[model samples]
Target: MSAAISAERQHDLDTGAAASTHLAECLAVDFATLLQTAARLPVAAVQRMRDAASKGITQRMALAATLLREAGQGDVTHWQSHPSDTVRGWACYLIGSDAALDLPAKLQAMRPLADDPHFGVREWAWLALRADLVAAPLQALPLLLPWTEEASPYLRRFACEALRPRGVWATHITVFKQQPEHALPLLDALANDPERYVQDSVSNWLNDASKTQPTWVLDLCARWQREHSSAANAYIRTRAQRSLR
Candidate 1:
């Protein structure tokens, strides 16, 4: 199934016209039964649908995710461990948006996906859970803080990525927009992370917050440097302060 989308993407570089058309055709025939039984579409086509960013693709993926949510938690959980990481990732994506589930329950299911071997799956893990965090930043703080100390750098990065004030490919978090200080605990935890990936996320998180609170950012970075500066911390501070004019 992924092979077909890859072929379609190759055939159409500038747009996903071929991919969208092929996906629609495949959904109509080859995957109809599987979609009905599992209540989730193949991640291959879904990922393409999202990456393609076409209105047609958007509508298709939204409908599929909606169906998966309606199918019930047991069905979603079954698909969450599908052999294909793509399938599992889409499962995580669907469950992350389960409005019926409380935020704690939704995030609990998504935590494992944050450490998924596949990068895209991990990305969706954060993306799928971001809205709930944005809606209640204070609530998200305690839930997300533990990940900052987790052994996996990916999970540590997820802590920052999930709570960024101005995340990419998602809506801006209005709470952080007004009071970036709310993120200090998570930022402090990752100030000197050994992993470059984690450090980058921490820095980017601060950079995002800094956009609307230059003085606060400047003060925080200065205090961090004064209190405990290391090579990694220096790098993060430098990266975060780069755009503060």
Candidate 2:
């Protein structure tokens, strides 16, 4: 193996040295530092972090979300910063739940950032939210909905994503049942939005909801089909295929 890879492996071994009989240590290393290092660490370092999941450092989990989001810096950035807190929140949510980045405020922070002027922050929040938006997206969703009409396509795109499934961590019956009316307008606006990201987001929402509320989702598809809302039909069809089945 290359020296770089070897060094990384050594670092992980040291940090994760003698995890407990529990297979993880008792949190002696500077977990925050480990997280920062983990972000820049070679892939092997990251794998070590994953292996150390048993150690259960809450801070590292948040760092992992940032690291994962910032990993490649291109299309990853695009998907990462789509215009909502969905990604960031969900990513944070997943990490939080898994015992890595356990901050309640991290998910809460995504709310106001949802209206951020910069697409990067907005996208970060949206993607992070995907980790757990359904459980408490209301904390942020109400704030994001108004922005759906924002002049910025990025903001609008993320707003649409506030409703998307992958955008949120997991689906909640309340998510579909509670906001059906409130989300309806946003759905209509985004159902055939001109921006591919925005339209694709709406498609994902309906597609995911299909599993929980297929009747509404099929009705939505039927309604969209009738209004010549073909803009996202192909994209939605492609994206929603598995969900539909």
Candidate 3:
């Protein structure tokens, strides 16, 4: 199956010409269940589905996610570990849809997704959780703090990625943009991480923060260089200073 969302597949979904084929690939047996449930939906609800056909892929996914959440049908947590990255990605999207789960529950559910074997799954985990964190930065900070000290590099990276001031493809955390110091603990933990993946994200986090607070980021990099001037730390510092330089 395709890892990336395919234009052709999205088109098929929009036109309803390949509902069976698209559903076969996306939800398979679960598609039949969705159809059965959708059939019983109110006329107004069915009309909403028809209207969403002209909307984008994300909207369609959000509608499905809402229906699944309302019906208490799909086990998104279970789908998080699916063999297909595409399925796993959608599962993550479902997790992010609206307030289906409370903040604590959402954070708990995101733990496994952050460390998923598939890189796409890991990315989706960040996309799925960002809005909640951005909405309640303080609540999220405390919950994510522990992840910094975790053994898994992926989890550690996720702590930084999800909290990035200007994260890619997700709403920015405005509070962090105003006070980047809030994420110091997470960044401090991975300042010298040997793993490139973790270091890269840490650098991006710093770079994102630098956009709002250049001097602070510069000072932090200087201090990191003063305290830990290893090659890995130097690389991180360099990347972190890219925007500033």
Candidate 4:
């Protein structure tokens, strides 16, 4: 975003309304603009833009995909190890979004991040799980599953959370089903996740799993009843029922 545009966006956010009517009524932009906006803003501002970008991409899967193409040119050497975990992590995910980028190189960039010591970076790890590296669950299963055992609860939680069935880099259910067991350990680690976000994400995973492996979810209900309680079981059970329907 240019300084003028950033100033305008800042004003719109402050006023809580789109300022388009006065500025030629531009409704949306390409992904690059969306990311550029996200990169330029503070965290609070970026959250809204990130959500907007996620929705926009969902609605326009093929349209701004070119933005993903341009993301590969970023110099990750400076970004990959940036002190601000948020910068390095998000940059990695953006790089992952570009399907044509080198997966091996991307993996090399992420390898250090996989074991990142900062909880803040660990939290965003899931956000950075781009599909380009693991179109199939089996391929990403080993890479993703091990994080569940990390001592940091944040990393453990995100180990499963990254494979979220929708939005950002991962929007495919086919990959989740290919290796149901791949999610098993992560689920176990997250069953008692302290964070509500992580807990809700666990439900989302089951909701997704219900589509591919009802037996596994059913077994989960049976085994976890003593621990997860009737309510959590009900949530998982409802997800199962919906899957069957």
Off by over 4 Å in 1: 1-53, 56-61, 70-74, 83-85
Cα lDDT tens digits, model 4, 1-245, are 33445666644433323323222223232333344543343354334445555563333323222233344435555555654433444455655554555545554456556556654445344445545534655565566666666666555555566675543345564656654566676677666655554556677777677676777767775677767664544565454446655
Model 3 lDDT per residue over 22-105, tens place = 333543223222333433445555456566666654455567556555656456765565545545555776777746588878
User: What is the per-residue lDDT of model 1 for residues 1-245, given as tens digits with 9 covering 90 to 100?
Assistant: 35445554433422212212333332322223334334444565445445544344224434456556554443566766654444454576677666678888887778778887666567667777777877887998898899888999889888899889998777799878779897788889888999999989988988887888888889999999998758999999999988885
Question: Which of the two, 1 or 4, has more lDDT?
Answer: 1
How much is the lDDT of residue 176 in candidate 3? 87
Over 89-196, each residue of candidate 2 has an lDDT whose tens digit, in order, gives 224333334433333454444445555554434544555555455655555566566667777676687676755643443334366653454477777776656777
The parts of candidate 2 lying over 4 Å away from their true place are 1-59, 63-124, 127-142, 165-173, 177-182
Model 4 misplaced stretches (Cα beyond 4 Å): 1-55, 58-73, 77-90, 97-128, 151-154, 165-169, 227-245
Q: What is the C-alpha local distance difference test score of candidate 1?
A: 0.70
Ranking by lDDT: 3, 1, 4, 2
**Backbone clashes under 3 angstroms, per model:** 0, 29, 0, 0
RMSD of each: 6.8, 11.1, 6.0, 9.1
Model 2: residue 229 alpha-carbon error in angstroms: 4.4
At residue 126, give the lDDT of candidate 3.
Answer: 82
Query: Comparing 1 and 2 by lDDT, which wins?
Result: 1
